[model samples]
Target: MTAEHGPGASDIDESRIPSWIACEDLLVKMREELIDRAIKLLNREIESGHIAVNGSTLFSSEANADVEEAMYLINNLIDDSGRLHKEYSEYIEKNNGKKLSDAEAKKFGELQKFVLSVEQLNMLMEYARVLSSWADAAGKMIEGKDTEDILRKTIDKEELRKTVLEFFINDSECRVLLSSKEIEAIKSVLGA
Candidate 1:
């Protein structure tokens, strides 16, 4: 059996195989399974209307474009995460039952960390969805009430807008992890 690295060890070389290839394979498989579960959770949320784009006057064509761009980023991130998980799994399976060096063990640890980050990004996407829904609802509220009154009554329109922008930024970061090409595509959409 290969020795397990402590959670605090951050110097694991992901490029090298660890002493226990079997353990690495198991970790890769677990990452893949977690990715699958996250995807399922996202889909279920969308289906259940927990994550939805409400129809509101606030959902202007321009805002919709931004929202769509964010969605694109989120989807691409999911795809990249899934692909990486598959590739890592394949690599492990090809060398099943073999002993890996410390360097290799480090690489596996890094892969696991990447998987965790992807999961965190997915959670952020869910947050963005909720924010989008709120904006839509708020826009509807504004449409019926005085704009000035609504703006004043609502404690933080600016903060809400900033949150939306931050969501887009987080989405962009996820895409950048996938590919420079994807990052460029997102930039083009944002006119940035």
Candidate 2:
């Protein structure tokens, strides 16, 4: 099963979920809950006969290979999306105050959708990485191991906050999805 195949998966009704531009805290909490569900499923599987335990905790090689493939595909998509975004921006800049033709506007809209998808994927990947590291650190700490260095290096609050703020500022489509209060809170955090 994929990482997303656990109980209460992303197959939930779209209308019930918050908008994409909901406050960062809400979005993060949603993701964290999903991760927690996945962890619980993994634990159950290990405890049951679904996954074999060989004394050392590790995922199956097939799972690792799937993750490797996903990373490769995501990295390629990010590179391609970056190049397309730059090219499209230049194309629009060359308009020199002229309005885009219907076809041009349609293409621009499609590009925006593609870029947004890539961005959302990137953000989810970031959340997964950070949360996974935090889970690992927590486990180590519980075992009486020193996880101070890991925690210090993995949790950079200011940098992450700035990144989220910048994302909201840069993506108007996503910004419009936020409520006024959410926007105001983000502004306050940025001291804007």
Candidate 3:
């Protein structure tokens, strides 16, 4: 305890809560942007049809780079990832099975969420598939004397996807813990 700091010290200067990392949220945005840019490259030359999921076909627009549904699922995943990370931080607060300070606990809860259920991995995979379809279509349209320049855009898009996918794959609670088959599906779509 310090005097200038509240009761005793003349040395303590600054203290503040650390910011939480929202990698998942940013990654979702990156994914959406990649699709959007790809669509622009090809002038929105895409198709629409029913999307097949888990051995069943769901009627939804198959293309045009509209990734609203994908975004919804990704946002849920971001929340879930935040909650999971907070859970670990909270767990670490317990020393030898003894509960820590109420302030710490409260902060953890505030930083986290009660709804812990994550977005379905299959749905995320489907989103990746849709993105890949758009990418493939857009890739074919790269032309003109600026072909090399446009191809760079494609490279950047894929790189962003890779970065996002790696984020999920590196987190055990997010996507790394997924089944091998499901992981393969994501990789195929991401061209990883």
Q: Which lDDT values do the candidates have, in the order given?
A: 0.44, 0.47, 0.39
- Model 3 scores a C-alpha lDDT of 0.39
Query: Poorest 10 consecutive residues of model 1 by lDDT?
Result: 1-10
What C-alpha lDDT, on a 0 to 100 scale, does residue 117 get in candidate 2?
55
Ranked candidates, highest TM-score first: 2, 1, 3
Ordered from best to worst lDDT, the candidate numbers read 2, 1, 3
Among the numbered candidates, top TM-score falls to 2
**Model 3 per-residue lDDT tens digits across residues 69-88:** 44443444455656665665
So what's the TM-score on candidate 2?
A: 0.40
For residue 43, model 3's alpha carbon misses the true position, in angstroms, by 38
What CA root-mean-square deviation does each model show from the true structure?
22.6, 15.3, 22.6
User: Per-prediction TM-score, please?
Assistant: 0.31, 0.40, 0.24
Clashes of 3: 6
**Least accurate stretch of 10 residues (summed lDDT) in model 3?**
12-21
Off by over 4 Å in 2: 1-71, 93-97, 143-192
In model 2, pairs of residues that clash are none
